[model samples]
Target: MDVYAANMDRCPVYASFFGAMGCACAIVFTVMGASYGTAKSSGAIFSSGIIRPDRLMQNTLCAIMAQILSIYGLVTSVIISGNLVEKMALHTAFLQLGAGLAVGLCGLAAGFSIGVVGDAGVRASTQQPRLYIGMVLILIFAEVLGLYGVIVSILMLTRSTLGVTDCPY
Candidate 1:
C-alpha cells in the first residue's frame, strides 16, 4: 500500500511537469509561427516595390496583433492548466494543455494568413480578384484549427469528470 501511494503521488507531479512543458512548447511554436509569417509578409510587400512608410506601419500593426494573440494563448494556458490541476484533476491539466496548443496554433495561423492576405491585397488591389478569394479561403481554413482545439478541450474536460479524484485545493 505504501508503494502504491508513492506511485500515485508521483503521477500528479509528473502530470504537472508535463503540463507545464506542453504549455511552453505551445508558446514557442506560436511565436515562431508568428515571426515566420511576419517576415514572409513584410518581405512580400518590400519585393513588390510597395514598401512605403505607410505600408510599413500597416505591416507593423498586423505583426503586433499576432504577437498579442500568441501571448494571450500562452498566458491563458498557464493559468488554466494550473487551475485545472489544482482544483480539478490530473487529466484536466492535460486537457488544458492541449487546448492551449490548439489556441496557439490557431493564433499562429491567423497571424500568418492575415499578414499574407493583407499584404497581397494591398499590393494587387488594382490587378487581381483571385488574391481576395484566396485570402477568404485562408481565413476560413485558419479558423478550423481553433475549432479543433475547442473540441479537444471539451473531450478532455469530459474525460476528466469521469475519473475525477478529490481536488487538491
Candidate 2:
C-alpha cells in the first residue's frame, strides 16, 4: 500500500474537529468561571447583613464581571467557529488550541479573583459604603486580566501561518 508515505497536501475532514473543540473549550471555561463567581458572591451578599437592601445591586458587581468574562469567551468562540475551514491545517489546529487555553485559563483566574475580592468587598461595603470605589477599581483590574487573554488569543488567530514547515529537503 502507498498510504504510508508523507503527504503534506492532504488534510482530513476530522482535522476540522480540533477547531470545534477549541470553540467548545472557550464556552466551557467561561461558564466555569461564571458559576464560581455567582455562587461565591451570592453567599457573601446573603451573609452580610444589609442596612440598606436597595443597594444589593452594588454587591453584585463581582458576579457581573464574571458574567462579562463569559461574554468575552462567547465572542472568541464565535469568531473561531465562524472561520472554521473544512480542512483545518495542523498549524491552525494548534493555534486554535492555544486560543482556547488563553481565554479559558485567564477567565478562570479572573473569576477566582473576583469571587474572593467580591466576598470581602461586599461585606466591607455593607458596613462602610465609602469603600465602594476601591472595590470597583479592584474588580476592574481583575476584569483586565481576562481581557488580556482575549487580546492575545485574537492576535494569535490573526497571525497564524500555513502548516508546512517540516518538509524534508
Candidate 3:
C-alpha cells in the first residue's frame, strides 16, 4: 500500500482532525480580529460622535468595516468545511489547513489595520472632514489584503480532491 494508506491505518482520525482545526482556525482568528477592530474603533467613534452627533452615522462605518473581517473568515471556513470528511487524505487535510490559514491570518491583519486606521481616521475626520476621503482610501487598501487571502485560499481549495483519487500533480 502507499505511504498515506499506511499512515491512515495507523491514525485514521488525524486527517479529519486537521480539517476540523482548519475550520476552527478560520472562524476563531477572524472573529478575534473583528472583535479587536470593533472594540478599538467603537470607542473612538462614540467619543467623537458626542462632539458632532451628526457625524455618528458616518463614523459607524468603522465598526462595520471591522465586522467584514469576520465575514471573510466565515466564508473561508464554510468553504473548507465543505471538503471535510471522516476519511480525508492527508494531503487534502494539509491543503484545507493552508486554506484556512491564508484567509484567517490575512483577515486578522486587515482587521488590525482597519481598527487602528479607523480609530485615527474617525477622530481626525471630526476635526477636518476632508480627511474622511483619505481614510476611506486607506481602509479600502487594508480590506484588499483580506481579499487577496480569500483568493489564494480558493485557489488552493480547488486543488483538493478529498481523496476521491490521487492529486493531479
- Which candidate should be chosen as best, given lDDT against the real structure? 3
In the range 20-99, model 2's lDDT, one tens digit per residue, is 88888877887788778777877888777466686687787777887998987898798888878775566776678788
Q: Which residue pairs show backbone clashes in model 1?
A: none
Candidate lDDT scores, in order, read: 0.55, 0.78, 0.84
TM-score of every candidate relative to the true structure: 0.60, 0.85, 0.90
Candidate 3 Cα outliers beyond 4 Å, as residue runs: 1-12, 162-169
TM-score, cand. 1: 0.60
Which sequence of candidate numbers ranks them by lDDT, best first? 3, 2, 1
Compared with the true structure, what per-residue lDDT tens digits does model 1 show for residues 69-107?
466456655555555443334565666567667656666
User: Against the hidden true structure, what lDDT does model 2 obtain?
Assistant: 0.78
Highest TM-score against the true fold, candidate = 3
Q: For model 3, how does the per-residue alpha-carbon lDDT over 1-169 read when each residue is reduced to its tens digit?
A: 9876676654466777888888888888888888888999899899999998999999888889889889888998998888887866777888889888888898889889889998999999998999999989988898888888888888888886644453222
TM-score of 3: 0.90
Q: lDDT of candidate 1?
A: 0.55
